[model samples]
Target: MLVEVGASARLFGGLEQLRQRIEVEATAMGVECIAWAPTGTAALALVRAGVPDGFASPLPCILDKLPLETITAVASHQGTLQRLGCRTLGDVRKLPRGGLSRRFDKELLTRLDQAYGLRPEVYEWVQLPETFSARLEFQFRVEHAPALMFGARRLLLQMSSWLAARHMGVTSFTLRWWHDVMRAKTAGTGGELTVGTAEPTQSVDHLSRLLNEHLAKVELQAPAGDIELIAARTIPIQQESKSLLPDTIRQGEATWLVLERVQARIGKAEVVRPLLAEDHRPEWMQRWPGAEEPRPRSAPDPCQLPVPDWIFEEPLRLAERDHRPIYQGPLVMLLGPDRVEGGWWHRVGEGADAQQTNVQRDYWVAQSQHAGRLWIYQQRLANDETGWFLHGRYA
Candidate 1:
């Protein structure tokens, strides 16, 4: 926790911003105390003395005011030191170095020198675990699912910090809870569900939102006494740095992420997005897939003309008279007969849901005096039932 930020404070938006960011992350990880000083020992003493910011004053000037008992090495010899009229670290410093060295262990002098930045301090780095799993015991058994968010939030904060420390992103995680001992056996221990994201993320807010949505739909089988969260899988993500320029425009997230969130709130099947198809025919050119489904890549528009504003579910058969299509009245051809001939190799739906699969037609940009401009097509099939139909309309 003793970080050297002096070299990179400006890179992180100056000292004030750097401090705020550190404090926010530390608080999220449940750190109770924090302090800043030039030396590690000085910072440690300041934190133990409840001084949140040790940088506001000169190093020795502040460390001198702290009680002798703040440092463990000094505290062990506190009674002896106090009897010798030493009440503070400054008082200890005034004692004869020869007499103090003889009276106390070497640790006392070492700690004193380290506190004043006269000696160097070495840090013991912590090794992070390979996987993350945490458990929280509820003081009162939770009967309602929504009541579990408070505990769930804490676990998520810890997980986020772990993910950041390890430089990884979580793709999926499982939330499982244990029921009270009084619950019936048939109801089981408790219910559990796995929450998955479309992409790897270490965003606690996004995870919390998904968890809240899923929890609302869950009917607790029994009173829950405790809950646990296990990260199923993780992937290393490239952390992008924010641009320092003020005029840089921020980019938005992919559309698929929005679709996935909506799918989480509602049912997956209930959410469908239009994806491009390989066919040339307008109706067969798009497919409705579930929101969670990955959208297949498509080629860019080849034609220069703009497409119609709307296409009917099924081509609306139009009444023909005088060898021309009629919607409300006689139609006037605004644009030419653009030939569309494809889909012979494909078969559409079956039964009542069947559709026109083979499209052999001459399309036109037509207008009716009463109905406005329309996209109509003349069936080129030789069958007697072949006629003109309205395919779409332009706004």
Candidate 2:
């Protein structure tokens, strides 16, 4: 493609930076050969002539440098031009324009004019679509999920171009594969696999790696006939601001991408974060399989009461000696008797003879000579029975 970057050089910072950016983008899209020139026609001619950065000077020698195919559009005039001793485009331009226009169509002179920067070059700009969906059909049926990687890579390259053109990033996408008609009875119509990113990304390598991890675990039911990739979700992405020091945003994005790959390889449910709950019972204070961001809970004034560092799943029953709970030796209470009650809702609709479901406890932070620091609670029962239990311990 012949792109006119002269007008956009300043927009992209400068000519060198613009060239570098274009080359980077083309590489990302898997484009191999790329050439640059001062004019659109010269760029195409240079690429066709196997030249790199073939900038056409305003001299007549540039005409000899270009291939004959560069002027193939005017093949009918080649003989007449040769008879006139015109060996190059500069030679043709040296001829009288009025006679040249009369001998050939106006397009010939127009092309020559545009190539030498005499006329303005204009072209329609391509726009990206709002959604992306691409499909590929293989000549042979794919028997395994991993075999679809080649076709998937092509679709990913197209997606990379689309994302770059739109200046957006994809967060989630789906890949669906269809089975051969002959194997439809065993494999059904097809199967679908969905992958999501922790953060929006336009990196083709990152997406491809994540897909590879997911496909490695997928077992195909039957031979696949075709594969399709669809972008299920996307988000706007801004160009990151340049910095002198290390970029924390990029570092965080890298970490998220690693986590995403690990999750794809294993299972999403296996990765989790802790969420704080509104409850007084230490065991029920936090919930697993939670949001990415941990929810913070308000802390009570330390001077008012001391909270245990650890809480056991099931409190251990303790023996008492001389009205004091014993664990290897008599326990010395260091902190308060903080009262915690209520569980009556569990027995609200039952009869009065029903067993009490409520709990009333006075918690205390105690220190035992042999047990070190311990969290003990005294449970009060309706039948006038009371018991002491070791609920937690501190290092």
What lDDT score belongs to each candidate, Candidate 1 first?
0.85, 0.78
User: How many Å off is the CA of 178 in candidate 2?
Assistant: 5.2
Predicted candidate 2 versus true structure: per-residue lDDT over 141-245, tens digit per residue:
999899899889878988977887888899999999999888857568999998888777888889999999999999999999899999999999997767789
TM-score for model 1? 0.76
Model 2 scores worst on lDDT over the 10 consecutive residues at 295-304
- Model 2, residue 180: distance off in Å is 7.0
Compared with the true structure, what per-residue lDDT tens digits does model 1 show for residues 78-186? 9998899989999999989898888789999998999898888777866779999999998998998888887888899889988988999999999989999999988
TM-score of model 2 (CA atoms): 0.80
Give the residue spans of candidate 2 off by over 4 A: 7-14, 56-60, 75-96, 135-144, 150-154, 157-161, 164-167, 177-191, 221-227, 242-255, 291-304, 344-358
Clashing pairs in 2: none
